[model samples]
Target: MASEYVLRIPLDRHVITTQRSLAAVLEDIRRVLHDSAPRSALQGHLVAAGHQVRLIIDRPEATDELVRCLPDAGAYCPATVLVQAAGDGACLAYDSVASAISPYQDEEALAVAELFDAEVLSLLRRVAEPAPGESGQ
Candidate 1:
């Protein structure tokens, strides 16, 4: 059985800025995921260096749906994105899809959750990529 985990992707610069806003990146993610900018169940925080967004995706393969089917599914509803200041850069972090599906040992559910993991990681990595013409290390 898989266990809970987190995936953190570092960015070349601060994403939570008016120039390269985290909001914009989040909106982009929503479009890619749902084709609409769904409301975030929770938004913004002072504890983090920059900002954070939390939203529940109630898709057929999401945590909410999984819980409805399998009661043992953990409290994975509402995925999260944290933009934390990293020196002059930033980091985009989130809980792995496996983290939410791990509590349920159902092999079928695990396979579906793995798909979510790949999609989420791809979106985050795309968001963290440096813009065109921008230097990256």
Candidate 2:
């Protein structure tokens, strides 16, 4: 059986409000992931709710040294990253499972979570910044 790991990163309300904004944010995220993890393959689709976007990242042949350290790392499962608009704010989530049997599964999961957290937060900062002539609210 596989155990799942999830990491949630919250975003400001103004960051994502409409379908156009969501699409822009998703594209930015895709670019960041592509640059950071070039080996990973990405696929995106809209969820049934029509308010969420899900991005699938497959790294079956992961070349990262950290992932390589885990036993049977070649069998690592794909990760699902979701962006959803909540009540007053938005949220970015990273979900993946530990499909391989290894003593370092938990550790690997944490490491992956941290990586996603950092990347998402960094992206948020860039996207949430105010324009040159506008004051941040």
Highest TM-score, which number? 1
TM-score, cand. 1:
0.56
For candidate 2, report its TM-score. 0.41
Q: Encode model 1's per-residue lDDT on 1-137: one tens digit a residue.
A: 88996644332221232233455555555656654333422222223333545444434435555566655554554445565434455456666656556555677666756666566566667756666875432
After superposing candidate 2 on the true structure, give the runs of residues whose Cα lies further than 4 Å from its correct spot. Answer: 1-20, 30-37, 40-50, 58-67, 72-77, 95-117, 128-137
- Stretches > 4 Å off in candidate 1: 1-61
lDDT by residue for model 2 (1-137), tens = 99998534332222333222454556566665655444543223334357777655554333253455653444433445567765444456543333222345457654653454444445555544443563322
CA lDDT scores, all candidates in order: 0.51, 0.47
Q: TM-scores, in order shown?
A: 0.56, 0.41
- Could you tell me how far off, in angstroms, the CA of residue 123 lies in candidate 1 after the best superposition? 0.4
- Looking at model 2, residue 90 earns an lDDT score of 45
